[model samples]
Target: MEPPDFVRFGRAICCDLVQASRREWWLADGLGGYAGGTIAQCLTRRYHGLLIAPANPPLGRFLVFVKADATLHDNERNWPLFTNCWGSGAVEPQGLVHIESFRLDGSIPVWRFAIGDLILEQCIWMEREQHTTCIAWRLANAVERPVHLGIDLLVNSRNHHADTRPYGFNSIIEGNVNRISIGRAGGPTLHFHTDDGQLFARHQWIEDFDLPRERERGLPDRDSHFCAAHMRLPLRTEWSGLVATMSTTPEAPATDSPLRCGEMLNRRRAHDAARLTAAVTLTPELHDAPCWVRQLVIAADSFPIVQPVSAKETKKELNEKEQDRQGRFGQRKESVIAGYPWFGDWTRDTMIALPGLMLTTGRYASARNILTTLAGFVDRGMVPNMFPDDGGQPQYNTVDGALWYFEAWRAYIAVSNDVAALREIYPLLQEMVSWHLRGTRHRIGVDASDGLLSAGDSGIQLTWMDAKLGDWVVTPRHGKPVEVNALWFNALMCMAEFSRLLKKDAEIFETLAKQAKVGFSRFLKPAGGLYDVLDGPEGNDDSIRPNQILAVTLHYSPLTPQAQAKVVAETGRHLFTSYGLRSLAPEHPGYRGRYEGGVWERDSAYHQGPVWSWLLPHFAMAEYRVTGDAELAQSRLAPIHDHLLDAGLGTISEIFDGEPPHSPRGAPSQAWSVACILAAWVTLERARPSAREGMAKKEESRQ
Candidate 1:
């Protein structure tokens, strides 16, 4: 039987073609980048090219190549290409490719390419002992094809940078160029000297590539920001596809030397050719039709081809069952297709995305595998927030990650109603709660005064609004953030519910539930309704942020109906943006209007005043529950859903500028945003009678 199709694996807006042996993958959009452990660095600074390659092992060396034509060039202005070359490196011209290297590291050695008017060819080769991963890019010359690309690699790195505190790599252009000018155009662009015969290479490498040293450095003033790379390759060939080659040295070879050339390529190709082909065809549906309500369908004729799965196989059957379960809970996107191309890291994203993408789509056992994969990383009761690409230790900086785990657990139970898994996870869940209460890294501790959780002010912004500029915390709520409390309340309730389901420690569950109820009551404010935070000792600062919505939307919440209603009303009134809920209200002094510009400028807008796409579903869920107006909730959610469908295809963006029709910011395919959307979509479909009746009453009152 053929392996499952790429679209059937999980719900992903974009897919990647990974040449694991080469440690590289090309995103669906034309840009290609390196896949280092826990990090994905963009090789190209601009979207002008169609190919990117990691020219060194462990993704230390990076190179980007673009096809240029006189027709596309501007005579009056020299088109300057930006390359992010960190560390200490030198670039020189070599045959058809450019060789950039740092002698001590022996990472990025050669980036070779041949560019023509219509066709572009690029190759990246790196050798670390007997292991080698190579990626080649061949793009068509057609100008009318849709540009497949991504942005905001720098923003994503901010979380890591905050924890480690290291100087970020800057962009530099190499060639027979004398002058280089950097400024913000409509978007950010770099201009430099470019003569007809000028040839150049750029690279970004760390001076001291040690993780421990970087972590000890602790919170640098200015880290990388607003970094993006894109490619515009015209599709001309009917059978265009990405090719990835990978090979590792066998423990013992029959012959004295390692396998080379034909044998290696043949073996690697046999395993990955179908996947590379599958990546292009698995694009998800964009419409909001009822058919999509059950499961999102993938077009058979999309750019990347996808192989179908047979029901007879055990693995396939289990996968289908998981997908069906996810579908019931409103998660119906494909993820983890066998033999399909995929990135090695992004474990948190994969696990969080599993329910909506696999289980809801009818792949139960696959969902179990995803959960089991994550659960395996439960160290001292903390599941990994992210995994390093090179198989290094996992990072657990995210405060919400464990909470999401509980949500996934509940979601799994909602589908399978399995008591055994719940029982198995109970101890881990208890430990996580205890760890949070005891206070983990970054001063994330639970308040003994009130049961509300306190996080942040330790330079690490765990919650979204995560960007830090210099010494300034972008949206610093140094005390008890509203959302943290909401989550804390929900976590307690979920634990109580799970405990009851497993029939273990009913008294402990009751005690915990009562504590959550008390905490919720204590956090409420008389005037602002639900305060955004209760900082320090006094429960003062009543900021009207949308974090309060979680208290109402989750399966079990401690908030009373009146308090929930107040939260919904206040959030809608002050924080709601056309695109999404703003991280902070316009009334706040920290708010910034424009979200696009230079590095600092864009990040300043992020979380300070930007509308996050992920918050929409949470907002919609709260609004629907409080108002019982499905039509109003649906209307409010319509534009958000439509916007994601239109701008990001099947996926939701990370954030958008809070001003006007909020422009998108960050990566196009964000996990939490998609999860929330799926969750809300299912909730809307399984509309309760009370909610429908409430909507009718609202309409009657209006009449």
Candidate 2:
């Protein structure tokens, strides 16, 4: 509970180059901007840097401050504290041998370097909600003979996803002003400031910086940066240090104690943890949760960012009648990023992640904003599949996002008890149900005969397993999917509940839900499992997939208690892994065992066999329902604790290899992956026997 080994490295790993280099630490600036690098102080991914900031709030990501390249001087020898990897497969300087320690102080990353009788500690962090990064160095031990610390300030002004190949781009540095400005003609100027350092003008193209993570993703492995200037800081006494800051505008020297940055970030985490605790006041016994749960509470804050609506949508001229209604909603929309380093905001991901990321974290305002923003995008009774990164029109190809909207609103209204907000959107929800019944995009509508929702067409992937390359759609589930019907049934029940809560007529939704439940009986396979899909061009597909588990896990399930146990047993028998449940059963004829290679190769296996951490929560909830044992259900999530130490520190990964020793793959940090795990943790915490016992004692005392 005291942070676990999530600080990651122990004393043995301090000097190991290969092991240390494989681990990375990430720090966010809260505006979709981040900075990270390996524990060995080496760059392994193009995304790793001291300053990866958004020039346009959440887009136009650029790597401005690449590295500081610190070197330490003790007595007659100079030791490098910075490690570098070249295209020639050689690690230069070998700085990890300085042999100290690496750790995470809350969200901040701290590295200590020890040489001879001198010990220097360096910390890297960003100011909250700002594009500024501060690298503070303090002398832990006294340097009797003035130790000279040299730092090469390297800068880059290109997209973080692309590699720079030095096309004669250079910057003019006006030597050592209060803060020397570095930039090229007509580009943004980056301010560099130091409390105690001498600046020297230098220019060179540092080429062939190797990136192993990029290579694994089948991208260019080489990158380049420009060393614009160098700084020399002299330290002769203990507790004296130099702080170098890079920002859009120069930050005035910190007049107060220099311990504020680390303390500020830690305070931020504490505030978030307190907010989550307040939200869970319904369960007092879970108030004192373990340390890892609080860590996840902090990690959950990273995905929800303030995404303002585009000017085009907000500024469109409207009639006086429409303008009067527009006052109820504003343009300051909120959304959840699907993942880091690559993914933009996706509709299904946002909806699936809504409760865990925002609601569970007690961010009610953000949850409302996300729901309202999505409501504004509903067309033909469907929410857009995703909003493009370039601020273009939202895509409308998903069949599930609209259904999940009902579930999201159900959860929000149940917790917040803000019936006025639901009344405002009640008509919109009714209209969505109408359109779905009448049919919308991609043949998405309730089947007249069965009352089940059916979706998909040629050359299009509509479901969440929708991975495609060119015209070749992988895992083309083109018909009535089991999960869609479960969601559709759940949504109808939620609508009926909403109608009852709002004191309105609910007969239509109640009737439709009953009919859908009756239709869902067709999916129960003879083998005591649910069919993956039914009424398809290929007929009944009894693929033994994990989708059926949602039927039992959702708030409203169509299956009976015995049937729920059957689905859970089938999933556990073949699909369960320590990491998560596999996408496809291993015994299936077309199952792809491992996920590897380029886009097409990997996408082919994306749903065929890859394991997803997000699905673990569904099985955990279902297992708990079938067995009524909280600890046994929580045990299903035990391996994920070991996972937090590697890959993405303090967070869960998107996908893992389907084979044994399931290695983590896909986005290092995923929204639904984290939200689901946190939700599962809270689920077990709330169901603990102590919680029920405490409630009983309180009731008896009151009586």
Candidate 3:
């Protein structure tokens, strides 16, 4: 896959190490595994590695190969080929000075080094759904001298989250004629097979590798790695020149060269692009959509992986209230890894992300598998909130997670028309509603008087604004959050509509939905927009937040058109930023303008004023509905296309600073962020000119 012209960087752009290190590249292996590092060839984050495999299905990630330090030998002298940061705060080797340019060949990271007249190219790629990594160095151009290269493999055997210090990690390294196996007792045993090299076993411990990014996140900043071996290779460009495989499994030495791997990688990208092209129905009409959208479709494919569940053993794993849900857990199902570096399969994020990531890319089978997988995990009428970091039992503390499932189904059924599948899950859906009405865990239940959902109690953060660091519930809109109720109302309307389609008792749901509408009316504020939360012990929260936009954007909005107009206008006046909608208006006293510093500081401002990318699509949709102008609404989302280059290479970020220029922060890659924008764009593409023409009236009013 040749690199996109716009994404490629030259020496002029990446001339400084600081600038180059800020630009990171990621490669996903489609099996809850990824390989990533900085463009400057420095391991800035602990996540930077050649192989970070899912040790247990999709959650237990182990960083097996940290990086390989190598040098280019031109007989006269040796040039450092890799860079590292030590605890002394010194950048060793300084390889960025030799890097002429860097680019992503599709998802693969490529670095070109120029030393005198000799030029060498290096790249890394992971096999599809496998723990195998191919690290290839090609001698692209050579001078009169015969160039030689020395590589030292830095190996680690620990969970990605935990750092390593000098320990009794006696990593046994054994070498054969063509292969070398490195084993850490009780940990993973990795095999390295080189196409052409003279291998020598060497045991050396490197320590105090300072991780700046980890320090920023308030983690152990110092790490150590075991250098397992050293190899020398004569530089040659022919065949898969100087190819090596560092993988979980043993394989024959590669004779097919790195060029062939490049070919296969390009073909894979082409196949991905074709799937997106076939899925798009509005291509000719909205033919001008930016190039990054298709890249997002490709990026979408990276997150979902096959998470096999044993239906029988789940009862022992979960609490007694989850017995019914555990009965059918044995299945090879699809689940999404929410993001790279750090995240697990989260039901709320997965459901909200499914349609845009899967359906929009015409990956119907994947979408169905994901929906079915989450459906299988429903317990006490609530879906699993998040799978713990180590593949442990899922936590079900979220009130909004189950509600999003109904909306996900609506989005899926709209495209698939899978009524048969709908019928199969109808009873489960009914169970969910009953559980919510009667009340479930965390005080999440329909208040009998208002017919509206009320969740959370003392010290419990139930809603999506759930950022609590050690009993400090930051931005806790515990009781009847605006978006939660909107979703609750939407879910009730869905139940009614679905009951009608199935020819079941629709009256109960219809009545409950009407009652909810009346209860929801209490949230409307005298000033404008709606209350952020209602019926709290403290009465009501009148923060001007983006949450109220959902009342207008959802499939069955309970708000009147006039009220919807007010919400949209208010959101535009305060919450809207070019990057996204801020969690709170900047005018608020509690508002934090920037997201930075350590973990607690960042989480403190997480929901206070950070602009969330996922909310942009909702605001965009609500604006379109209010103005009846698809073009204008679509234009609002256009700026995000340019943001793709800012962070995550070609995908959207989780959040940005609430202030102007809106620096991207949080998870560099996010599921809901990509899903929301992709879904919204597709909606705009399908939008027809309204029957009521208000373009001129809207323009005059704006003026």
Q: Which one wins on TM-score?
A: 2
Model 2: per-residue Cα lDDT over 1-703, one tens digit each: 1222346465477688777877777766666677778888888888888888765656556787888898987667898888899999999988888858887665667788877678888777766666667776768877557777888888887777777868556675663633566766644556676555677767788898998887877778888889877888776433323333434433333434445433544554465546556545543443566656666766787687675334344333555744554557666777777887666668899899988887776778788888987666677898888766566667787888898899899889977998988998898899999999998889998899999999988888888998988899887788899999999999999999999999999999999999999999999988798999998898989898999999998889999999999999999998988888899999998788778776667888899998999999888989999999998898888788778778777778899998988988988888999898887878786797976687688779979
Ranking by lDDT: 2, 3, 1
- Superposed model 1: Cα runs more than 4 Å off: 1-354, 388-392, 437-439, 537-539, 640-650, 688-703
Lowest-lDDT window of 10 residues in candidate 2?
237-246
Model 1 score (lDDT): 0.45
User: What is the C-alpha local distance difference test score of each model?
Assistant: 0.45, 0.78, 0.78
Q: Which is the winner by TM-score between candidate 2 and candidate 3?
A: 2
List the candidates' TM-scores in order.
Answer: 0.57, 0.92, 0.91
Q: Specify the poorest-scoring 10-residue window by lDDT in model 1.
A: 299-308
Model 3 RMSD in Å is: 5.1
Residue-wise C-alpha lDDT for candidate 3, range 32-108, written one tens digit per residue: 77777877778778888888876675667788887878798977799988888899989887877888888765566
lDDT of 2 at 671: 91
Give model 3's TM-score versus the native structure: 0.91
* Model 2 ranges off by over 4 Å: 1-6, 142-145, 172-177, 185-189, 196-201, 234-286, 308-326, 694-703
True lDDT of residue 672, candidate 3: 83
